[model samples]
Target: MSQTNPMPNSNETPTPMAMMQMISSRWVSQPLYVAAELGMNEAFMGKLVDLEMPVIAGGRERTETEYRPLLGAAGFELTNIVPTQTPLSVIESVPV
Candidate 1:
């Protein structure tokens, strides 16, 4: 009897780093979207805070100041981080 399926054409195996990059890329995307939606990218400019802000309006209690730095670093490995000692910010928000 003959097998209906044969081995894959490529004799080479994918690199561990490459596979990790692919998986990490997909996982990181959601945080970027959330950060953009939350406007953490703008944090570098001024005192922007919603220390009591929810992930969404009428949603769970969340702090943008705390989470923003974390999200940015997690997904992109940010070159800089705002001072952790700075209290929650409340600068005039530019409408998003």
Candidate 2:
């Protein structure tokens, strides 16, 4: 009689979430890779990067007060402006 191993294969397929995360990470990191290759990352050093946030409150608009403190705590200041028809109910940001 031949002996058989009972452990699962180490090369098992990835789950749906794992696959999605891999794909999304590749998509998001590719640009960064190119930027680094082109020396753009160094050029943008010591600059304030603009961050965007989308706020939707049950089909109603929300005030900056609702998000300012949170962003402030994280070292970001509210821009006090919302883009028109951007699908985002509110946009907030902080300087990194």
Candidate 3:
């Protein structure tokens, strides 16, 4: 008779919430990747490079929403239901 190694197993399953988090992480990563590819972070950083404001956010003017889809492709999103020339505080990265 040959000796066999004994293995221990336990019942541990993934919860629905855990699975959801995993799925969401993948979805958000795509957007982040696109944002990085489009140089979104560099663009934003350039604007703030020289500004005299508590917080630097500029050059957000006259952007055509027509290219929003392109931005989506690059994992970037800028949405504002209100019609104003104001720029919202947004950075290029994974959206929360």
TM-scores vs. true structure, each candidate: 0.20, 0.29, 0.20
Sorted by TM-score (best first), the order is 2, 3, 1
How much does candidate 3 score in TM-score? 0.20
Candidate number of the best TM-score: 2
lDDT of 2 by residue, 1-96 (tens): 432322246487655444334434443233211112233353353231222112223234456786777556544576755453323334545353
List pairs with backbone clashes in candidate 3: 34-74
| Regions of candidate 1 where Cα sits further than 4 Å from its true position | 1-23, 27-62, 76-96
lDDT at residue 93 of model 1 (Cα atoms):
21
Q: Write the per-residue lDDT of candidate 1 for residues 1-96, one digit (tens) a residue.
A: 332222233575545444334435453233222122344455652323453334322333335565555444434333333333344322222111
Q: On residues 29-81, what C-alpha lDDT tens digit does candidate 3 reach at each position?
A: 34332112233475675565445243222322334454365445544454543
- Residue pairs with backbone overlap in model 2: 76-94
